[model samples]
Target chain A: MTASLIRILPDLARYAAKALTEKKLRSLLTIVGIAIGPMALTAILGVVQGYSNYVINQLEGLGQNLIILVPSANYDMSSSDIAFLRDLPGVKEVTPFYSLRAKAKQGVRDIDIAIYAVDLDVFFHALGKLRLEEGSLPPPGDTASAVIGHYIAFDETGTRYYRVGDVLTLTYYSFKRGRLIQHSISVIVAGVLAEFGNAFFVNPDVTVFLPLDAGPKLLGMKKWSGIIVVADSPAYVENLTKFLREVYGERANVISLIEISKVVASITAAMRFITIAAGSAAFAVAATGIAATMITSVMERTREIGVLKAIGFTDAEIVTSIILEAILMSLLGSAFGIAAGVAAAYALSTRGMVLQGMQVVIRAPPEITLPMIVKTIALTIVIGVLGSLLPAHRAARIPPAEALRYE
Target chain B: MTRDYRAVDGAESTLGQSPGQVPILELRDVHKVYKVGEVKVHALRGLSVRIMPGDFVAVMGPSGSGKSTFLNIAGLLDVPTRGKVFLLGRDVSRLNEVARARIRNRVIGFVFQQFNLIPRLTIYENIEMPLIPRGLPRRERKKLVLKALREAEGDTSWLPKKPLQLSGGQQQRVAIARAIVGRPRLILADEPTGALDRATAARIAALFIRLNREEKLTIVVVTHDPELAHCARKILMIRDGRIVGAEAPQPQRCIAYSRR
Candidate 1:
């Protein structure tokens, strides 16, 4: 049997190829149906994954073993909550901070920047991102004395806009009793922080550090913006985040790299579900297209099938010839689909940045890995075989007597 | 396989009878019953016939007289409902579908009344179709196809044209070429001139006579045409699913006949 198949391979292929080309429109439509599914799947998934990795990498650069929690609506990180968080088993040091975006008036140029109101004593010890470049951190109770970031005195020339003991007037906006209000306060610059690179959550190169009590006394603030918990090591970060989440529930957002990764994982899983669902829908349509076209082909060639059988063509040969057409179309679709999908992903990535109001969001380009392409092609081939199998069987099972009698 | 081919080749040394040779095909007490809803349609009833090598025979019958059923069983397209079928002295009535199809492809060729040449194929490719089932190489199939075309007295120019491009006489010649291309031991033809003009029918008869006498090919043609049947060495008359008469015309009486 194998020997006969070896000899008859060319004839089988020839017949199959002729059958496909005979009805060019139907074959082309079926191929296009197959191409649509893999294209959508690859492009959507590649973009999602690329952006996911970008966010995760950015979070990793903030710091390690660090958990930041911010208060939400109707919830504030009060003294009692800070005390409770500090007393937890993996306790290291907790830094409750008030972060405000403000502008300091220097001559005619009003420099817009961030102000971090934190404890001066242990704040430097808890997180090691800062070291005073001039003078020193003020004593713990000095509310108006402040340490400044390099960019706050942002000057490209040899001129310095801020130095120690310089009284700087800063204006900031806040909600006071359900109304937006602007407050101006004068602060004495006690020290200057060294210049540093970009940071995700907190940037030391572009901020002013003031005493903790300064928020309520000078700016009419009722609560701290958030608290940063510094764990002893990276291993304790997960447990600490989990414990804080259970304690705070929906009142606070506990954030760290590990927690961010968990969020990313869930997002990726949701992305995978969406891709499969949409891809499967398209694949199902392609399958039906193939079956319909193949059935029509089989019906049209019933008399030819009769002639083949009468002339001694075996059932296996007949079935093989029909299915060969489907396989060829599937392969052609795969090649074109993958090329189009990858091209679309790159095109989308080129315009990744979107500006909504005053905020700018950037997205990363998609990655089209080899494994993804291989898996897609394999799946398409299987679908092609299964879709056409019924018609092939129907063609082969035709009785020569009845077939010869048919018109 | 080569040795076996040589032995079969030696048997064709001379066209006359060689004693102790097996009949190319034989049927004994065959019956065929087809189901039509609740009714049993018996297509053939206790039919028996045999064709030796180099013999040309014809079966003449009215419509629905089981002539087609006889040819179907003898050609291995079907099996007998009862009794035995023998191919080259080997009992084959109980063979599996695969085995029966192999016999149809390798041992016997079929010529249909409608001249069933595949419409999409050129005449050359149509002639090569039966050789494919034998798994013969292209070079070998080409040689046999060219030889069969000449044996059928077909125009060499028809090789590149599709069957539909040819006339009825020309298409029938192509069909005959396809049947004999595989060099089968038996050629089973059903209504060889059923759709042809009288002149074309006479030409087809003359071709069959030449293949049977000159090439030593065994043949059984099922037809009701007198001109076709009278050229055969023996004619079996069938009616109501059984053979009722047998006639053998003298060689001198048939205008298309040249063999003794």
Candidate 2:
């Protein structure tokens, strides 16, 4: 056995090299299909992962282990409901919110804006995700107070129309209360938000802040859209959700950052399945490429097989040689494919984009796991074996006389 | 005579010495047939022939005359459909494929018409191929390969050159070296000079005759050329899968000459 191995090794190596060199372009093209899927998949998954991560981070940053309770299918808030929720057990904070489509009027200049009202004391503690870039929080008992995002404060002309202590008028319509509902309010824009994107602090891409207690009188609402609940600790998060669900009896929509993140993960997993389902076609094509090459190689070497048999090589040896050749080809090709995929991933990760006014960061690292590497190798081996079957069998079936007869 | 060229019938002369008369190959009514679907083609028809020690024999026939099949059977590369073939007086027909292969590798060397040298291998590696299954140490195999290359008497530099780089005559020499490298008792040449020019053919023929004379080796040459067959001491003519006629170059040389 050792003697046979010693004799066959050098001969097989020479055979493999000669086969590869004989058809350089065809070999290169064959490997291209193999590299595409992993490369595209890595880059796409990286970006999706990065974006999802950023959103989750922002949500968790609002408050740790916190829950937000809202109406089952509503999008508004009222002061009366806020007062009622404020007295509920396990509710650490309650704040009413009123947001309306309004236009800021500043001495013959107008900009679209969202007029948001809140209570000064409760807003300061319960404004979970309202971050300010360049302004202070509303003071205690400050009825005419407001703050804005960074982008809403500046215009393309570098003009600041609304700022702190600025009294600007806001417009609205009226809704009759049953027989006589009405709505009309022109409130002051006490503070302009900081810059966020391409809008001024008082622009429609902007938001105006007002006193929470004053929202019920202005918007004429009897119920609240949502209520914020801060747990005593992370341990109480599940209990709070259960308590809220039991009380609201399906009328309340409770969403937590953890839940949202889980949703994102499931969605990404589904997307991955779709991507792989689509990419499998490409892989199949690559496998076929390998099969075709192996078949051609077998046809070309029919005489060689005869010679080996004539020289005392068994049927097993002929089959093994062909299979070994296929495996070597796949291994070489897959290696180059993986390297190309990684290089492509890295190149696409940078150059972040904007989505929904949030920065979309792409994270394309090699980020390859051990299982993925193993899977790639295993897949290549399978393909190699499958590819060599026709060739190996053909070589094995050649009658010694007929094969030797081939020139 | 430099060496005794008598035949060895070891069964009669059991002196524990070769007696210089070893019947290296013996066939008793060997029959080989090939079946293609329902048609059975008889390639060898109850052929019985013996190759004695130190005898240079030639098998000449037309195409499809089954001479190649006879050679294959004699070399143990292929088995007969019926009949017993003995190598060194051991019945090889009963042996398995692997056992027969071992015998083929060790007891017999083959020289093909096309010079079947692997194009990628150098002359030295080509010669070394037959020695690989010998289970010999590397140093020993190397020594044998070099010695065979030296015996070929071609350019030693060609040892490192591939077959294509060498001429027809040189390639034939390499093939000869490869065949004789393992020092097999019997050498089978299947149209060894069919591809070479007349002059190169004569040289190869001279080499074979010299090997048989000097080493007392048994040789069987199969060819279609009548002139080539003339050089052998015994010429067997085959037609339609049977030995039609046989001639001994010197019948006057009696059985005494064959004995000693």
Candidate 3:
């Protein structure tokens, strides 16, 4: 039986092709019904997964082995605390910094930007992905120097707003002697960093960098608010984070970039589950359409089946022919569905995600992995097989004598 | 010789029962009961008949006289309620449906009143239908299809066209080609010309006579046309589910008439 089935597979396919082509409109409609499920699943998953991957890659770029230590309420970190962190085992470098939510003005155009007063050279090494677009990082102990972010040098529309030699005015409010006084300062733009997209801790596209000593003189920052610690490699990041948590206790929050990326991956997985569940609903409807169409085909071809049986076709052969038709339809449907899905994914990716104070880089084209396509095709085949079960069974059980008499 | 070969029910008439040779087909007291929605219909009473290996026999009866039922049983398309059916000395009555289907395909061929060609398939594919169930190789099936078409007096040019695209006589020829392509020893045709005009029916009848003589096949046809019945080597009159009478016709005329 197995050998004969292999022999008749081509004939069965030919027979099924004729049936599909005979009812062109119904066949096309049924194929479209099947296509909808895969299209929704592939398109949605591509966009979400593409964006999540972009975010994770950017976070890793920010430095996979870097751990950030932030002081909790009513807590402060002095120079001795920074020295203590640098002395810890497996610690590569420790750079304590102060950040002010400042507004920068260039020709009366004011924009919100983070002013980070950290050692520019050490900061660039610890935050690995930032590169200088215009000039070099600030010289050591150069409190009068500043490096503007990409958006500060070029405005939101990408027009040139500030050059490397430009002096920028920064304004921040501080409470002194029970009065809120807005303090203003000027610093020379030593360099302009290139466009770095969203990072979990900071968006480099909308920040200003300065030398470490500038924090104490310009911002009157007596205590370090944040410490960026670099581990020797990503392998040591978790250990360092655990060790730092025990040392800082409730007075500080320790975070590793790798952990943030892991959280992002899990969230993406949950999103995939919801999308597939929704896609399966569409497949259920498509399966119903396929079942109805195949049932009608069997009913319409009653006399033809009778003739086939009279000429010695077996019940199993009849069933195989019907199932073959369904599989053929699904193959045709998936080819088109995958194409449409990838196209939709690319189109949906162009709208960048914007937040209150951070600007994400304009979206890149969506990614479609090989496994995604394999998963889509696998799902379609399942529905095809499931849809044809009852009809094939009915076709097999039909008695030749009665079928021959059908009009 | 006619009286010697005539088989009567329950008479122990040794028709086609030569020494060390069995009949091509034999039925012993076969009964068929049908149910039409709560009504028990006795379509066939206890009927028995036998045919030799190379006989052209015709069973003639009016509508609802059990000729169709006999054809179904003889063709292995349906089972009997009582008694045994033997084909080539094998008891096929007790076989499973799959086994019965295999015998129906390899040992017997059928031609119905309607051509019964699948309209979606080309004529060549229709002719190849019988051999497909046997999983015959493509080259062999093609050779057999062409040869059977020639034997059935069908033109090879019609091979690429659908059954509905041909004339009624041509369609019946294709049907005949399909039935014979498997090289079955027994051929059962039910009202082979019931849908054709008189001229076409004569042509189809002539083709059957030619096939019978040329192929040495055992042919059984159930028909209402006496002209067809007159051409058979042996004629059985069936009524009320039994063989009422049997006789021999002048078979020389069918041969001579086919030559025209």
Candidate 4:
């Protein structure tokens, strides 16, 4: 066994080396077709993984035990909605949010912004860690006080737009008037929210705050977009979810942090299948290239096969040597291909793209970890072995005398 | 060395009723036929011959006259349809394909008209080819190959070269080295000098005679050149599938006549 193994090893090495190094262009072309699948797959997966991580981080940053609630358009809510939700058992705090697409004008530049109408008193109560990097919060009963996102602040003026007392203008559409209502209310740009660097585009500072009762009157708001509820403890997260479900049934799109994360996971699973299909196609093409090369190699080495057989190489050894050559070529190609892919992915990921509305460099998640690399290698190995099967069998079946006679 | 020699002798003794006078290879009424669709072709017909140890015999015949076919059967490259072939004492006709291959690798070596030296292999690797099937250790196989090269080419220093690098004469010598590397009982050369120039052919013929006399290696060569055929102590001439004539068994007479 040892003798047979030793005899065939050098031939395998020679064949593989000749394939990879001597015939470099052909080898590269073969590798290109193979590399496409994994490259696209790993990159897309990296982005998806990064995006999911960003969303979870954003949610987790909001606070641990928070459940978001949305009102169904079919089911109108009474003015006692806040009190009804607060009165529920284990309820800690409830903050209603009203958001609409509104235009913001500073001097001459008008930018379309998402206007978030929040109850400043209970809003900060739920989001205590909300940082005001430039300006301060407006006082109570002040309808004219507002804070805009950092992007608006920067775009309006060169930089440093929000100070302690800079008033900002917001244009709203009043349904009663049935026309565009430009509200030139002298509101201080209370604070400028710092940029949370990511691909996502939600800016809370481009927000106008009002007293709870005055919210609908000033913003002409009818239905709330969603409500943010904080749980007293982490343990009440599930109970709060159930409680909200009981109250809303299917009417409200009541969701907790965990539920949102699960939705992202489903999206991730779907992405996985798409990338796998794409990668599998690329791998098949690469495998076909490998098979063609192996068959051609077998034809070229007919006389060598005969000689090896005449020397004492069994049929099994001859086949194994050829297969070994193919496998070695594939593995080496995969290593180079994957390395090139990873480098490309890293470079592309650092560029601007929407990941959870933050302007941040979203690096691929750790899930594209060691197992993924190992799996790529294993895939290449399978491709190699399967690709060489026909050629190896052909080589093994050659008659020793006939092969020896081959010119 | 003596053990291997005795093994060959012991095997030869079991061949037929003749206890000690066993030829290295004995073809007893061998017949080979081929069929293509319904058309049958007889390649050999009741051919019988005995090649004794240390005998340099040449089989001469025209193309398609069964000389190559006879050589193929004698070399164990192909089996006869009928009758028995005895390598030493073993009836190869009864042996399975694998067993026959084993005997061929161990007991017989072949040189071909084409030189059939594996092109990709170096001279040394080419010579070592026959021993690979014997499951010999790489170290021992290397030693035998080096020994064969030394004996055949006398450390010519071109022994490491490939067949393409060597002259026709040199390549034939390498083929001879490969054939005798395993020190088989019988060496069969099928028109071994057919592709060479006159001088190169003469050199190969002389090499065969030297190997036969010095190492006592029985050599069978097939050729159409009468001069080359005349160099052998025993010459068998085939016209159809059967041996029609053979030179008399008188080595001394030929030497005496040549000297006079």
Which structure among the candidates has the greatest TM-score? Answer: 3
lDDT by residue (A272-295, candidate 1, tens digit) is 898989899988887888888899
| Tens digit of per-residue lDDT, candidate 3, span A1-407 | 76787788898898899889989999999999999988898789988888788878988998888889999978988778888988988888889888888898756788888888887777788776888999888787789889989988887678888898889888999888999999999999999999886565677887889888899987897877799888888999988888889988999999988988989899989998999899999999989989999999999888888777777777888888999999999888887888899888888887754544455453756778899899889889889879999989888887787787788
What fraction of the correct interface contacts does each predicted structure contain? 0.58, 0.12, 0.53, 0.12
Worst 10 residues of 3 chain A by lDDT: A353-362
List ranges where model 2 is wrong by over 4 Å.
A1-11, A33-64, A72-225, A231-252, A347-366, B1-23, B52-55, B94-107, B120-145, B159-162, B181-185, B213-218, B249-260
Docking class of 4: incorrect
- DockQ, cand. 3: 0.57
The lowest-lDDT stretch of 10 consecutive residues in candidate 1 chain B is: B1-10
Off by over 4 Å in 1: A2-10, A61-64, A72-97, A101-172, A175-179, A182-223, A230-234, A247-251, A343-362, B1-19, B155-157, B250-260
lDDT by residue (B92-176, candidate 4, tens digit) is 8776555656667678777878777766567876787777556577799888988887767635576677689988878888888
Best by lDDT: 3
TM-score of chain A of each: 0.73, 0.69, 0.93, 0.82
Give the TM-scores of the predictions, in the order they appear.
0.79, 0.74, 0.90, 0.77
- Native-referenced Cα lDDT, model 4: 0.70
- What would the DockQ be for model 1? 0.51
Using lDDT as the measure, name the better of candidate 1 and candidate 4: 1
Tens-digit lDDT string for candidate 2 (B1-260): 12112221211211123555556787777788899899999988877777777778888889988998888888776788999898998989888766766777788888889888877667887888777555567799888888877766666788889899999989999988988888888889989889988777877877777787777677899998665676777777778877766664443332212322
Residues forming the 10-long window of minimal summed lDDT in candidate 1 chain A? A353-362
lDDT of each: 0.81, 0.67, 0.85, 0.70
Task: Give the per-residue lDDT of model 2 (tens digit) for A113-181.
Answer: 576665545554543444455446665356555665443456657766666655556665545655533
